[model samples]
Target: MLQCGVAIAAMLTVAPSMALASADSAMLPRNLSPWGMFTHADVVVQTVMIGLALASLATWTVWLAKTVELRQATAQARERMAALEGGASLAELARDCGEASDAVARLVQAAAHEASLPGASWDSDFKERIALRLERVEAAMARRVGQGTGILATVGAVAPFVGLFGTVWGIMNAFIGISQAHTTNLAVVAPGIAEALLATALGLVAAIPAVVIYNHLARVITGYRALLGDASAQLLLLLSRSKGRPAVAFGRAG
Candidate 1:
């Protein structure tokens, strides 16, 4: 009789723990990894993640394309500046530089055209007119080279908010779920909370690099514009030096 009573007591002690273990196990998330959380996340949360990912992809693409573009363009502009410093006449530089579409070439072309105008030698505002043309060309070149960087700025400024929206929506959904299930168990609530935070994590993932890349590209573009400015100054010097040789800056070259 006493042995039977001990067995009954042992079962009573172990039974609730066993049942509770089973309940806890049931509440635990099957997958808590990032990819797992994403897959199991609410549809709205998933959409936010996907958008942030695309933003990140755009950021990286801009980085790669702009890096290559700036490298080649800066090198070319520097070479042209070196030529400008050599005091090559605008007419000579025009033919030697080739391709009037590049920034430096266009500067030379603009000066050449302005200097070759009728009565150019007698025009008291000759250098001033050429300087105006060079300035316009420089502004246009800066705008062109900076074309794609705007997207980076946009992403950096907006992505974190996008992620926060996902998190808020997710946490809201989690609370709704907890209310419906009529429980405040941590096990029941953690998965949803974790999944929601993942969106923010992805947001940071998309934003930080975008901000960094934008700043870097800005610096590169500033350097390029400075090079353009130097070239313009050199062209003006060439014009001043050619005062004794009037045809050098004022007449059309065949």
Candidate 2:
């Protein structure tokens, strides 16, 4: 009789907890995919994930546009540089540029404009002023070419932290679920954790490519700037050679 009473008491004490654990376990999903996990995530976590995905898309988009722009600019600059070095006159070169807004074209036009000014004699002061104009044009062109890349940098730097915030929010919800369910079973805890980790994975997916793209574009831009520098040097060379001749004489020869 005493043993029977003890057994009954133990069963009464443990039954509720076991039932709670079973209920919590039943509530967990068996198969989880990225889409399913996202759908099942807390609103905040979902938002973070969506934002990261959009950022990743934007990174690639910028990479595509900027890559094309840089390639065309570099090619045009090389062409103009070749022509400039081959003793093409400013009027001829400007005609070749022909209102096309490539960086090299802009540099040539700016230099040509400075050269065309009335009474713009070829002296130290004249060269200094032309040099200043070329510098401004180069700086402006660099800034224009680099416009959309800053967003990629920001995305690369901040995405992981945004994912971490999502993960933290998810884990907090998991703990809250544990409290409500009154259970600590692996089945109940694992699903929430997996979902939370997916956020971090998404973040890395978004960030790593952004960082790589940003670096690649930076290098390409640097190379493009070097090409511009070469073009500028070629222009200065032509100016030096024309020191004693009439500017019209140089323009007429080419």
- Model 1 spans with C-alpha error above 4 angstroms: 1-28, 248-254
- By summed lDDT, which 10 consecutive residues of candidate 1 come out lowest? 245-254
CA RMSD for every model?
3.2, 3.4
Residue-wise C-alpha lDDT for candidate 2, range 27-129, written one tens digit per residue: 7876688888888889999999999999999999999999998888888888888888888777688778777788878877787777777776777776778
Best by lDDT: 1
* Structural similarity to truth (TM-score) of each candidate: 0.88, 0.89
Question: Best candidate per TM-score, number?
Answer: 2
Question: Per-residue lDDT tens digits of candidate 1, residues 51-89?
Answer: 999999999999999999889888888888888988676
Query: Candidate 2: where are CA atoms >4 Å away?
Result: 1-18, 249-254
Error of 1 at 66 (Å): 0.7
